[model samples]
Target: LLSLIDQIPEDQRPPIKLPPYDRFGWFFGRNESETYDGTFQVGTGADHVQNTGVMRLWNGANRTDYYRDTCGTIRGTTGEVWPPFGRLRGTPPNVTVFAPDVCSSVTLQYLDEVERYGIAGLRWIGNDRMFDNGVHYEETACQCTAPEDECPVLDNGAMDVSECKFGAPATISFPHFYLANDSYHADITGMQPDPNEHRFEMELEPYTGVPLSVKAQLQVNLHMRNYGLTLLQGIPPVMLPVLWFRQTAALTDELADDIKIILILPDIGVYVAYGIGAIGIVGLVLAIYFSVTRWKLVGPEELPPKRAQPVMP
Candidate 1:
């Protein structure tokens, strides 16, 4: 069908009568969110990855097509056993392409900025230098040479993630949604993206390095081009935004309840032990008091006088 669309000229191409397009997208039930069902067919044909029960993100499966930047250099100068994919890499583009989420961080300074500015903060958190968290927050967002930057490129605080996911076929992002720098907004001329709708965030308990609430969000897209294909000839040769989702783990009511339990259980035990200890102490004092009083007062009152021999009485 794609080839057919490509072969058809613009004038010959009618309204392109099609059904509800329920078949437009393929579902693997991997990252589909119940909260959203947008118009675009996400992961339509590409990124067809499924669980192999391996309990790992990259299971040696090729889930993406290899694409080059304008410089004609394939990503991953190292030996990529899987074309666009190299061996199991943790940071930069490698992990992001096959992995679900990139572990990134915002500096204490930037987080402080967010707190002060609310959601409109723009403090440079230094390019993904945070190492406290085990996740490598790639610096540099969008990884593009400008123009047609509609697809999401995560903020990841300050990490440059341009090298992620081969930097083209699909983009791994922080779910900035749209609250990214104005420069990104300027590049997106194809879509009307809402910053509030697509924004991703993390609320961390700074002192403890605990993520109070977090939304590890990212987006997947398709890089399309005319390339003499009649099907895509009418549209601009750009990376089209398909679907964006997040892996959100948060402090929910249940988790909060568990935490409360965790906090209160010890205290309850200590308090109970203290109460028992107090009772024991009080009992010991009362016993001592009763014995002393009986010996000194009751004993003296009830004590029989020392008697002489019976013969004398």
Candidate 2:
């Protein structure tokens, strides 16, 4: 029977979709609540505080891309911040291609997670406008260039200028909480055969302050569950777990402070059980107390008052 199964063509085999493991993507965002100054009387208050940004999972494709910028706004003596005017305040362009061909069915699950966070739009770029004492001020325009290894085409025929332009915008509605300056990652496995397998993983991290730096890292771990299965069958059952780590660092203290890290977990059953158990214990104790009090109030006198007097005599 096993031999017959082996004889069948690979296409005839049933498609097996496994649940994504610890494959995780992280995003960081600054919480803005900390920067508020209560005192109404103030000269151009200190620079507006930007909280650490938020994060999200990017599971659309095997390739990860990053784009970022630092924006600033000045405060007036009356405690008002101005927005970037014209082209000066506009966010830079960050674009990439996303399609089913670049990832496996299982890897697409990250898209579902992203939808939960309300980050559907493909706009990943950010710009800050700064005001110096109510005056529109401009910061040095940061240089933008792709890494040598990332832009292999640069080494080839006259660098493809088209590649520099932003691609068609792709929108993804993630189902998780995500904020600005978050990181995204995707990993695809089971692309190769036998001991030599092909897998692809990528990362994208965004930063929002001056001297911004984005770091994206991907790590893959392959473990053989049953070696014997490989000898008997052409394919071996294995477990592949991928992890993505992304971080954005900036020189500005406020921008660095705006960096937020969020860790989420799927199973909250333990917390639910604990809450239920606590409520049940409290209910049980109250019931016991009420029952004892009622029992104590019901005395023998309720049965017969005359009989009790005769017993005392």
Candidate 3:
């Protein structure tokens, strides 16, 4: 919807000047993630059970700049909020259930989704969440609503990057628009947001901590509020949710078997190398013994043979 109308004549543009960026408060992250709704050491031998505690942000916060969204910070403090693992506000549900090396039987419940992972050998996998395709709860990422709400925290059902994201007020909602609040859907025209059509979930293998199948489900939207006397005129006064997409990557059974083979081959190769080395070492010892005693250099009768010959002479 935005691509068709993005081109405005140079002279017909709005008087208000947009900043070089859309939002300029926070950074980004990597595979390094902090757990939510719990306090547990990652490598403490327990990764199944979830203990409730402070949420944390660990590693992979590189991008300090947003792509296109930018507004000069003057009123509210639009400062960078670094990711530190702590408190309810900091922990996101996505990274909370599982931590590296720490496998507790404790299952964590996030909103409508309860995380109950099943162990596979030495690792855990998404037994509970793998099939969790339905909408667990309402996703409210915006702060325009009730005062007591926590906005922008992922575990709160959605991830919000309004200021530091692409220009059109965007919020990433879970796949199954299951209980998408009315406020997010009421205004957009020509879009019928249905619960059944949009719901999505992920499948993960606990042992490898690798996503067996991943469908990065998200919804794109434009926050259409207060569009007075601008190019956005005639737009509805509501959050114009445009579309949602799920980017998927998965491991087929054959591919999964291939991966397992790939993972096992190296270990087998190492063991074979070790076994060959051991055999080679034993052979070397035998060869050295044979070479050293080839002519009976240290035979008990050697000294006597010389003495007996001298005596006989």
Candidate 4:
């Protein structure tokens, strides 16, 4: 169908018919079966604490063809898994994750310390700077260069993923346009952004680098504008949000308990050993001090016994 549309000359093409759907119905699910045959090669380093799982190959390619230059480079672990931080000196300021679906690597900023089931975790959340398309964040300028497709110049919080989607007029943003520009909310009527609910975040046990809880939220939008095509005509320039989704996960109670026993108990044992050794050293010092005092108290009386023994010799 795409090839057919391309074959038709723009000057002679007729008004294309669009699929039937309600105009206002943007939040709904469609029952469709899809198949994915992509391969991911990840290097499982010696263990969680050692050289751990980092992405080696994505869909049989080391680099993506979506964006140009370093923006297309594949780095960091897949969003789902990461190498263990293990006994680091301090909390990490950020964590890098390579999102294969988005065809980019995103850095999750450290928000705060959070605890679940008595286990402490470092909460990392996506900020306003990550999804920028060179409008607000200048570092992502390379991402604006779409290698094969014409990428739109979107405002902050929305990223053009048309090349990744095989030239579909698709873009991705935070759910409800949480960090998007005010103009986007003004253009749409039903958008109500909430930081508590719409934020994409992950909570990790910083010591083991285990994800205790995760809520990955993303909204898919269609850049609907007249591309000199009949079907696309009569539509206002708008980023029409088609659907939004949130993927969530959490650690079970049983697993949390196991982590405490495995990781927490050893520290308690070390503390107990130190306490015992401290007590023993204090007792030995007290004994030495008391013995010296007793000898000093008998000063002249103790000297008389030594003089009598010297006279007998």
Candidate 5:
């Protein structure tokens, strides 16, 4: 019905006589209760550090058919968990995660060091490289098949997820288009991209890899285009912002204290063991020194004279 209506001239097109529910409810889903289930494989225990919480299979599959080439391949961890970063070794340049929503591995660059709840952590934020759409980063060329004059290439920092979202003209970006190109901002109003509010960040305790705080913000947009259709003639080709969301979490003080004890007490235990060993060694050395000194202090002539007189008798 929509395709047929789209073909009609805008002036002659039939009005939407049906009610709202009948017209658009199917887009949401079936009203009846149904179990939407999937299988997820996560790395655990000793394997977690090496595996870094790998999403081995999602819905019983290890890959996605969202893109044409390797871009569709499901690589990296599930983004919720990461390998324990060595504080002594310092922070890396970036971190990668296979975000199911984006249907690809996204990399967040190391922004800076941050502290929360009295615990220090490394903060990583989504940069222009994340959704570059091949403008600045050649590695992301496979993410989009549209020509250089496409909607996303014109506006960097937003990736077209239409293929992943079942052919819907959808795109994803940071909240308020934080790192997006100026062209996207020119089409909209009241969009203020502040790093404090709009930046998507993950702050993790470097030593234990615990998430001290996380603010994962993402905006979903409708890629509006006329497509030379009669009913959609006046629509401009733009990434229209539909809705934006921010998912946030922070470590509580109680949890922070528990983590401190869990991470710090072992080093204290080693120091205590070393102190006890040192005390025992010192005591043994003093005892041996005193015994030798006492034996030497007793004159040799006094002990030898007494022994010789007894033998002669």
Candidate 6:
């Protein structure tokens, strides 16, 4: 069977493709809103759990700046609010959960405010490094209907209900540096975002060989649509892509084998050859220079340098 599989043509083999992902897009103002609901399975057998928190901004406020809200609640397996729900009128909320073990799973449902602009969804995955610390990994699957009473204006002058579906799913992954050992910790780096297909890839150095007891925290940001007439008309809305990361214990060995098979020209080899060739050319030039100078000399010792020396008295 292995021999037969190897005999198959390269083109006949399945192509390597990324996992399913999504991205969040801001809505153009017109009294439109979006929501997302999804079930997440936490791997790595984490002991503790916490919601990383949510951020949002309205028109005239700084773009990409999020003020934490306090209106959301995280429910446990018993259907009771885990940390208790808080009211958020003008602010976003912090939805965190503390799970008992890694065997637990949770369903996340989030609703955005009704704005003339639509909502953008960001999906994320976590690494073991996020456990115990106040970090998280989350993904926003897609939008759904807002809670009955909390739904915003159905139709704004500029927005149509049907247009809200334009948003795509994106995967995002990055560390929540704010929860690091120091408040002045390094900013989350190595984040790659692909808005078109809604995918992201990031490597975590801290979570490499940690035991299964370490839980991975997924963090996601669901950006609400901005409704400013200037922004809606003048500036093109930027796509908020999602990110994800999967733990692979065998990745290191696999990568090492790949490097061995790959061919790369060595810089030292090239330079050494060039240096030897250059030295040979220089030696030939010096021989020629000496021959020419001697040919021009009156005698074997009559060259300028030899002549310049005083005769032995």
TM-score of each candidate structure, all chains considered together: 0.40, 0.19, 0.39, 0.74, 0.79, 0.20
Q: If the candidates were sorted by their TM-score against the true structure, best first, what order would they fall in?
A: 5, 4, 1, 3, 6, 2
Q: Residues 225-252, candidate 6, lDDT per residue (tens digit)?
A: 4443243454333223233332222124
Candidate 2 to truth, TM: 0.19
What digit string (tens of lDDT, one per residue) describes model 4 on residues 245-312? 89899999998998888787779999999999999999999999998898899886666554454555
Once fitted onto the true fold, the runs of candidate 4 whose alpha carbons sit more than 4 angstroms away are 1-37, 47-50, 146-152, 268-313
Q: Which 10 successive residues of model 3 have the least lDDT summed?
A: 71-80
For model 6, state the Cα shift of residue 80 in Å.
40
Name model 5 segments beyond 4 Å from true. Answer: 1-37, 68-70, 146-154, 227-230, 297-313
How many clashes show up in model 4?
0
Summarize candidate 3's per-residue lDDT along 245-301 as a digit string, tens digits.
665665556756655765567689999999999999999999999977864786665
RMSD of each: 14.6, 27.2, 14.4, 7.6, 6.5, 25.2
Q: What TM-score would you give candidate 3 relative to the actual structure?
A: 0.39
Ten-residue stretch with the least lDDT total in model 4: 22-31
Model 1 stretches astray by more than 4 angstroms = 1-168, 174-184, 190-196, 202-216, 223-239, 246-259, 298-313
Quote model 4's TM-score. 0.74
Best by lDDT: 4
Cα error, candidate 2, residue 307 (Å): 22
* lDDT (0 to 1) per candidate: 0.37, 0.26, 0.38, 0.77, 0.74, 0.29
Model 2, range 1-313, lDDT digits (tens) per residue? 4345455676764332212232212111223633222222222213433311111112322223322132111112110121111122234332221212111011100111111122111122211111011112222121112443342211110111111122211112111102101212113232222111111211122222222222222222232233334443554432233332333332344533443321112236667888999999999999999988877798666644554545554
lDDT, candidate 3, equals 0.38
- Which predicted model would earn the best TM-score? 5
Between candidates 4 and 6, name the one with more favorable lDDT.
4
lDDT of 4 at 257: 90
